[model samples]
Target: MEIRRTPVLLSWICLLLAVFLIPGHCFYLPGVAPADFQKKDPLQVKVNKLTSTKTQLPYSYYSLPFCRPDTIVDSAENLGEVLRGDRIENSPYVFEMREPKMCQIVCKLTPNEKDAKDLKEKIEDEYHVNMILDNLPLVVPIKRLDQDSPTFYQHGYQIGVKSPHSEGKDEKYYIHNHLSFLVRYHKDEQMDVARIVGFEVKPFSVKHEADGKWNGDKTRLSTCDPHARQTVMSNDNPLEVEANKDIIFTYDVDFVESDVKWASRWDTYLLMADDQIHWFSIVNSLMIVLFLSGMVAMIMLRTLYRDISKYNQLETQEEAQEETGWKLVHGDVFRPPTNSDLLCVYVGTGVQFFGMLLVTMMFAVLGFLSPSNRGGLMTAMLLLWVFMGLFAGYSSARLYKMFKGAEWKQIALKTAFLFPAVVFVIFFVLNALIWGEKSSGAVPFTTMFALVFLWFGISVPLVFVGSYLGFKKPAVEDPVKTNKIPRQIPEQAWYMNPIFSMLIGGILPFGAVFIELFFILTSIWLNQFYYIFGFLFLVFIILIVTCAEITIVLCYFQLCSEDYLWWWRSYLTSGSSALYLFLYATFYFFTKLEITKLVSGALYFGYMLIAAYSFFVLTGTIGFYACFWFTRLIYSSVKID
Candidate 1:
């Protein structure tokens, strides 16, 4: 009886553990649980932020003088949503399931000068109004003739349009005062339930006129009337938005049954051009890897093997001394590199980044971080980075010990602060600019304090603990002993120059991922979904291989040239790829984006600089470890006595 009771208690504990360990979205099952609705059920339409690609800024939906609900309440947001400037709030627009309502009057607003100016600015900037229904974002569908699937989706509808004045003078702003909403739902005949799968809208600007004396009834409008069955046309006189002008807001809702299921409803929204480009990127990266693999194989199997054989066969000290190249520099090759402290910090930071990305990608590939869990990716990344401080400190401490550095605590402090400090300063400056612009993209003060707390209160203490543990362990042993006097490096050819070799080595790694980078940039800046974590993980692996191989190849060349200063060279070799990344970003900005504001341009470059710097550290660390391993292997294989 006691044994049976023990098993039952253990089983109950296991069940509770599983429930808490699983992702929040997993409870909902197949792609966010369906919200079932019966006929005539009230469906609340929630308004989100007004976003503009040109400015890369988001404003609240009610920032403009539009129709408002009696009491506005912001929805609860996750950390990622807050960081991304998503401000979702309850709106007055409500729809009934399977109910069609035409020419429904929402409200009327008379704009002041300030409101008119703000609306005009948003129109000129091409701001789009985002709304949500049943967790599905509203989109404007576009039909493409050349595609097999004829329709593509634009995430949100434009707030208004700037048109030339009737007299062909200056441009005038025309607000989209009327919206035609189409909600598509999947209905289960057996269960007698319906779930919304898609939300679409077609907006129009109608200068509505009242018949006879104007009443509060919407059927009295001449432009759109439900009783008369009069609908708003595209060619109807547009409503001009100006100071002291009345803007009548109206909408029509039509529900249609769709064949798409609740599980696969997000498919249409996530669709892009094709997977051909991704495959092309993979093939291109594979080609680089194959080429580098051939080079590395030749060096290892033929050149190094031959050198080792010849050296081992030498019976006299004179014969051994006659041999030149890498064999002559075994002593200085393991010597501590210049700026060892900085190198340790960078390597530690890279380890932190690598752990964060690797774990995040694994979770994403496992379907833990689904699109339904909005902002989960970013949130996971931040938390993972913070927790990875332990690894960062440990790695830095071990390297510092290997370098024979006396102050382990100093190095650990540097490792903990250097990288994050640079990032925080840049982020703070960018946030200040956004705040001055009155954009929702600016992180609030509370969030800022939270970030600071996560860094100092959590990450810093973890780093100190890791550093202590690492310092208590014995230092790593070098394969070859270093001499008291450093060997003078021989003259190197023009191609063997550090700058030339580093720049040349970076090209291969950059080529490995530039295509994938384009799609990533598009997803972030253009407000599209990026749910291809599997492919991204593959690319990431390929990128690591390419960086390591390129750096190893360059390090071999430098070693053969009798240059023992390979540590920094190895790092820079792969890290220089970031330079190309920044240059490509600049090119992308000019060609792909239509950013006209100086602030927007500054923001783009500033954020891109941070990305490039991180890339530099990540790739540089990969290269250093690869070269370090290569040197140890070769030096250990040969007789160093």
Candidate 2:
């Protein structure tokens, strides 16, 4: 039976291995629709935003052409250009944006002038209450005499807006805003790219304007919230349009071209990080690592060694029976934990998450997932997580049966669905709220169905296959025999209590990664770029070492206290970092974010729960196995009759 089970499991593993390794027909990254590198010279601009610059939060922009494409609706790949963050709606302003014109149309007297009031109302309703440039993307224009032109990083843009009264009541007319590009150069005036230092912004809204044409008129407006307080005041001119003529708004996006080689674009971004904070965090984590390493060493070399030596020297059975400490607990050390089936299910899910994290990080570090690749990282993670279900099922079923459990089917079912269902439910609820807000970030119904199909079709069947094979195999061999009657656990001191120890044990692991956590949080919420996967991989290794070493040290202390309930303690001790992470996130929000909307706040914390839960499972899995191996090593070495 054991031999047969091995072949079945191997077959499944081989099949999956082939699937992942194979490229063309196996899997393709979905929903990545980044603009092509050099589609055309000066890509005809996309769209204008509907939201005002005065609004606090960022708003969506739409594609005027895609909404009303006339044989020029060029889109790449599977996604329609309109569906991919391109607010496609009918708008009168589309033409003004597409074909902006600067004209001083004098309202020539018509045979019988059309109702001036109706024309004014029509213009106000059609044109979106005047227009303002809130955000824009700029391309790098440089002439490098080296190899073929290197890819230039796009500059971030923010055109500021403001008014006269900080509170209310103000008198002003049509105001003017000017934009200037600030350029920086090396001491020698050499550069590969001329990075924009900043931009000069002036914002105002039209308080009033003439209805017809430029026939000597005046208007009202307000001024800035200034950057580089050098404003070019303009004489108020009667810039107007008639009802029957074509009205156009014209502006130029002139580039401040430079002739210097730029520093490596990647290095420029990396320098933005404060080095001191990273060093401080690294030193702090190292100190904890050294402390835990010393403690584990002392226990293994002195305490455990001395106990094992003393037990071996005892000649008579009575003398051996008198031995204590960890040697005495060997009989019940491998005893099945209370609710072993549930514990096994939990462990299995933890294994799955850990496995997915491991594979995803490796791929990221290997350069398979770069910033240019867009959705590659997330797509890879999702696929790997689904494929890891087989391992989850095998681990859960194998452990459950080892605990002398008979319900293999029950354990397998929970292992497959429990954690995933919880995450999906929370995600669906949050998505519904996003839909209510009519945000583009909302997952379409088709995408949701695709996710469900992936889960039911691939993950579930793989888990079932694994469960069958695991049940066919014999239970995992226990190093020490269990007694029919359970051993009575001794009362532990305050310091030795599971909760206290678990709390203390968690501090080190959390400290190891808190510095990196800050940068990650900033990137997500502040919308900054974060591409430090190489550094993150090193931190990941440090965290793994910290978790295992601390758990082992704590498990040793618990056994010495004559407490046999190491099962939950081991899991929670490392998993407790999730608690610290949650607390830190709360602190980050209060201190860092200015999020005012209740719905946004709810969405923030709701997604955070999912992240924290996954972290708990991943770290918990590492600690459990570390303790499991430690317990098995000590007990199996003792001379048990």
* Per-model TM against the reference: 0.94, 0.72
Model 1 ranges off by over 4 Å? 1-31, 145-149, 164-169, 212-219, 227-230, 315-318
The total number of steric clashes, by the backbone 3 Å criterion, in model 1 comes to 0
lDDT of 2 by residue, 412-494 (tens): 89888988999999988887876776655566787677788879989988777777788789988988898888889888799
lDDT score for residue 30 of model 1: 23
lDDT of each: 0.85, 0.58
Supply candidate 2's per-residue lDDT for 17: 40
Looking at model 2, which ten-residue stretch has the lowest summed lDDT? 22-31
Q: What is the alpha-carbon RMSD of candidate 1 to the true structure?
A: 5.5
Question: Across residues 546-605, which tens digit of lDDT does each residue of candidate 1 receive?
Answer: 999888888888888889999899989999999999999999999999899988888899
